[model samples]
Target: MNAWLDDWDGNIARTKGVCWIAGWDGDAMGLNQAGPSIRCGSLGEWNPDERMTRLVLIGTDIDENRVSDTLDRCLVRADEEGTSWNPERGPFPRR
Candidate 1:
């Protein structure tokens, strides 16, 4: 699972021209930054105008459907946060 996810992360970063980072916290898997969920943090680790980072969690035993749903929700929440994310612009587009 880790190998596959690493590949996926690399692919996302390469293809999207954005940083993709994730980690396991012994419970759910967390995405520190991915796709359109990018934003600046308190430390100013990211510049949304240039790059964005955000955290979203997907629990253990995840499947494709779960990943899709989580990303959709992330996009929605990002939009609510005033980000103009075009869901249709990425590999996963809210489906």
Candidate 2:
């Protein structure tokens, strides 16, 4: 998780846009601009059984597909039967 956060921070620092992430504990929510500044916080209540995340990015030259692809890699995949969502092998690969 720390490694992923570090990498995400680095990416946001280099990106020429605004970015925000909201999720459960250990995951930070923030508004990152093109600079060494990020205003971060939580998204209120967190329900462990229903874990989810919402990320938003906006910019003039942002590649929508690239952003989607990158973010999609961070998601917790659904099971084959679509009856389960597991974060055990998420981007951070946590259980």
Candidate 3:
């Protein structure tokens, strides 16, 4: 999967949401416009040893500490189940 992030403007940048593509394959959808902010929760093959989430924000004057603190509050532990082993996608969010 691939992603492209674009900032529309400085005014409504914070309120902008992501757009999903039903069948996005090499620009075959024909919905090619501007300002695409879609992102995936993870990238590349799943690694059982490394279960992590990395979010990338496109803006000016970005503070690493502030973003990390805000994200810590926004996301919480889904469950307390063991995420040690999985055949398909290792270390999945507890369901």
Candidate 4:
């Protein structure tokens, strides 16, 4: 399975309510979009061993500590996303 990530934008309603992340499970049936978009829960929940990344939305006004905790709770693996691309048209880079 694949992992999808999302962020919380600075929305007025969001400030008062819980923040939610959305993504494509690459499966949930829908219109033209090829991914399943959900709220706070993640598609990553389906794959316990999979690795997922989180990108904080720029406008979010929450504290950094809260963000870190959220990432730890949400990301599939606890490291940074793989940087750099394959030297050749080869496999994905290592984390």
Q: Please name the candidate that would achieve the greatest TM-score relative to the true structure.
A: 2
Per-residue accuracy of model 4 over 41-88 as CA lDDT, tens digit each: 222233434423333333335576775676566543435335332224
Candidate 3 Cα errors over 4 Å, as ranges = 1-36, 41-45, 56-58, 78-95
lDDT of each: 0.33, 0.42, 0.32, 0.32
Which stretch of 10 consecutive residues in model 1 shows the poorest summed lDDT? 21-30
Reference-based TM-score of each model: 0.24, 0.40, 0.34, 0.25
Model 4 TM-score on a 0 to 1 scale: 0.25
Error of 3 at 11 (Å): 9.9
Residues 1-95, candidate 3: write the lDDT tens digits.
12122323332233222222222111111112223433222223334454344333456666657655654643334562344323244221111
Task: Estimate candidate 3's RMSD in Å.
Answer: 11.5
Q: Model 2 lDDT vs. the true structure?
A: 0.42
Candidate 1 residue runs with Cα over 4 Å from true position = 1-41, 48-50, 54-60, 77-95
Scanning candidate 2 in windows of ten residues, the lowest lDDT window is: 15-24
Q: Score residue 23 of candidate 2 by CA lDDT.
A: 26
How many clashes does each candidate structure show, in the order listed? 3, 0, 0, 2
List, residue by residue over 9-92, the lDDT tens digit for candidate 1. Answer: 322431122232222111122233364343321232443354443334333454557555545544334335434433234333
